[model samples]
Target: MNQVNTVVLLHTVLHCHFTSADSIENYLFEHYSASMKPRRNQNELVEIDIAMTIQTVLKVDERFQYISFYGWFEVQWRDEFLMWNETEYQGIKKISVPYQQMWVPDISMYYSEEHIHDLGVHPFVSVTSQGHVTWFPGAKYTVQCYLKVKKFPFDRQKCSIVVAAWQTTDRMQKLVPRARSVNEVKGIAENGEWEFQNFTYEENYDAEFDLTKIVYTLEFQRRYRYFLLCTIMPIVILSVLNSLTFLIPVESGERITYCLTLFLTFTVFLTLFDQTMPRNSIDVPYITVFVSFHLFLCVISTMVSILTISSKRGQECDSRDTQIVPLESQGEDLHLGEVNADGKRSGSSGKNYLRRTLKSILKEVFICKIDTVMLVMNFFFLGSSAFVLVICYIS
Candidate 1:
């Protein structure tokens, strides 16, 4: 096995320029000297720049930001024999390599600690000159990261998964991600790693490279709890109320009133229900059926009441003579003049009393029959109303 040795290097550059008094410059120089002296060898910077490139493989959760994975390419500076020079400071002096291997720092573990609510992620590879001499001016680098589905969050039958790529530049702050249109440039899955099959890059120093972020979103249908509560509960209560109408007695004077009141109440309820539900000729809802039944009950009760009253009146007329007594028996007869002395004499004698008896019987029949018929009709009306309400409840 061939083994390659690599070195890690750290560098710091002063980004501030001082124009105001030399105080700032002097302070920076003293600070730099103090910090670098211990690590420096000889009278020069121990670090040198080399042409170094970086490629990273990072796995971050698109939904939750709790955990993540990161991997980076190993890089080190190599001695070049071809660049050796003859007579000037030439003792094959040990040169400092500028490229270093990247490692995860404890502070960079969770992004939430940085107060960064939004994140832009991309697979990036960058090349920079490591030596102070700036040997490689324009070498370019490329990197591509692919996502693999290990397990799905929901059942496949209920939902689907999608992956999309997006690139952000200064002009566009945020752009929606979309699936790659080119078939050849799509991601390739092998073993566990999904690789970008057709990714490519050309070396360039000044041009801005494309740094893109990719994201995936999942959506599904869910049942709403409020809809069930608002719609189903009231319907059940109305049905129960309709059923309770049967408990009323037939003899109660309020039977007709009760049935009619329920009918009207349900009509109002139906109006409310109609306002909520979409207008369609689809199968009638159970609540509507209940309302219709109550309306029918109202009609039936009314008819029966009318019929009962009519029948009672007829019976009363038939038994009127039996129900009433002769007015002559009270002894203050105003028709005394109308009855001649013969009639009175006959009335007193039991001989011609059959005619008087026949008249009395006719009068009693008329009055008694009217009274009987009215009583019967009232009862029949009440009884029929009760029967219909009971049937409505039972059915």
Candidate 2:
């Protein structure tokens, strides 16, 4: 019936020159309705040609797990009601004017973190006499994406954005890609932290929703130079220092202080770093493992330092007691006589034996100087940290 009307209008109105050129649009819009689908028959599905032209990547927030980008959606669909005979419109092939609330496909973003879709630059669409409508609406789109930071500053992340007609299933309308695939063709603004490697588009039928979802998987490699200089470099330096803590001579008595200081510093840094990462248990970062191992190293160093100091003090106390006993213990029997002066020989003998056994055991830990033990322990911890770093690289 619509084709018969168009045939009759072409014959009758094709040669009638209008007094005003505006009459062409007025005539075309007269047949357009905002609420009804613009198909010749309501049962005929409208195909919307969809494509994304990314202008730039605004930001990728790791703490919040979202990505923001400035882009335009190239949407084109046919409007059967808005078709016209070009000869009747003074040979005008196309027209660009304000969008007249014409029916458009109900396509939407499935992974939008916040709802802030807006019409770009006054909402105008170009319509050809053949009834093809082209609209490029641009906006800053924020999509919720899960980020993996196990490698931290050197990690590559994969995020996806779903474009689908959520309200209208595939049976109601079909979405056709304007191009073979989506990519960053337009000039992309460089991001300091994340490097846009590339993107791939997946169009597949979703069985659960009975809808075909267009998912764009974006791959990004972190620009690790900044992190290497700032975050990772410091961690490496601290790990090396933590291993060196044992080398501090126990004779100076500062090894204990050094171990405690490094432990506290690492703890503080770990706490600060935790705030910048997503709070999820799905994956533990290798950097965290590296730092934690060093922390455990600090604890072990502190324990060794304490035992060495205690052993040294015990020797000094024994030396002072020998000098005071019978003028430097001129005779062994004189030393025994002085120890049992309180007439509690049995109790004093038991105490002396236990003290000697404890000091003998402590001597095993130090022998003479605990520096060798500390160096060996440091090498072991250093090897463990290197192993963790290898894991981080492989991952």
lDDT of each: 0.33, 0.75
Residue lDDT tens for model 2, 159-260 = 888788767777678888766433463246677777887766778788787777778788888998988898788888888888787667667878888889
lDDT of 1: 0.33
Top lDDT model = 2
| Clash list (residue pairs), candidate 2 | none
Which candidate's TM-score is highest? 2
lDDT of 1 at 130: 23
lDDT of 1 by residue, 338-376 (tens): 234234321243323555567556655644464355345
* Model 2 quality (TM-score): 0.83
TM-score, one value per model: 0.25, 0.83
